[model samples]
Target: MTYTPPAPAIVDDIVSKTKFDANGLISAIAQDTKGVILMLAWMNADALRETLLTGRVCYWSRSRQSLWRKGETSGQQQHLIEARLDCDMDAVLMIVDQTGVACHTGRRSCFYHGVTPDGLRDTAQPEISTKELYGH
Candidate 1:
């Protein structure tokens, strides 16, 4: 579906309220409509603005030092359902409709490791192989 962005003024107001860190980044969390946390990433102002403008999830790639559009290569796009800020405005919560595995490991969520009595363990298994997700 074609998603139309909000008015430029609205976008500006929202962006201005976000408190990016000294590195010009803020934590972004993507959750499904069912309230299942999918993944956590980082975003700069540009990434957040683009996500709002395009209705697709985008993040700042600290390792790559660039804007990363979720699922750009893995076919796991996240369509934005809603975007919200924390009380301090240092974090963003994105409600999204996820297309496929959210984790590069091919898991449904990035938070698969769990601390248990038996030490850290994987709580979930990959739904798709890494090769299948990335064509690597």
Candidate 2:
């Protein structure tokens, strides 16, 4: 289904209130409608603007120093359902309809490790294989 974005003025108003860090980035967390946390990423102003304008979640790739559109390569697109900012406006919580796995490792979520007495342990298995997702 095609999702329409909010009006430009509304998008601008929302982006304007966001508080990005010194690096011009803010934390963005994506969750499913079921309240399952999917992944955490960063977003610059441009990324935020694009996301709000397009209904597709876009993030900042700190390592690549460019806008990273989710699922661009992995086919695991995250369609924005709703976006909410924290009280401080330093972070955004995005409720999304994920197309596929949300993690590079082909897991349902990026948060797969659990802190245990034996140190971190894998709490979930990958639903899809990385090789099938990335062709590596």
Write model 2 residue lDDT over 1-136, tens digit each, in one string.
3557889999899899999999999999999989999999999999999999999999999999999999998899999988889999999999999998999998999999999998999989999998889888
Q: What TM-score, over all chains together, does every model reach?
A: 0.95, 0.95
lDDT of all predictions? 0.93, 0.93
- Candidate 1 C-alpha lDDT tens digits along 83-128: 8899999999998999988999999999999999999999999999
Every model: Cα RMSD to truth: 1.6, 1.5
Q: Candidate 2 deviates by what RMSD?
A: 1.5
| Candidate 1 weakest lDDT stretch, 10 residues | 1-10
Give stretches of model 2 more than 4 Å off. Answer: 1-4
The residue pairs found clashing in candidate 2 are none
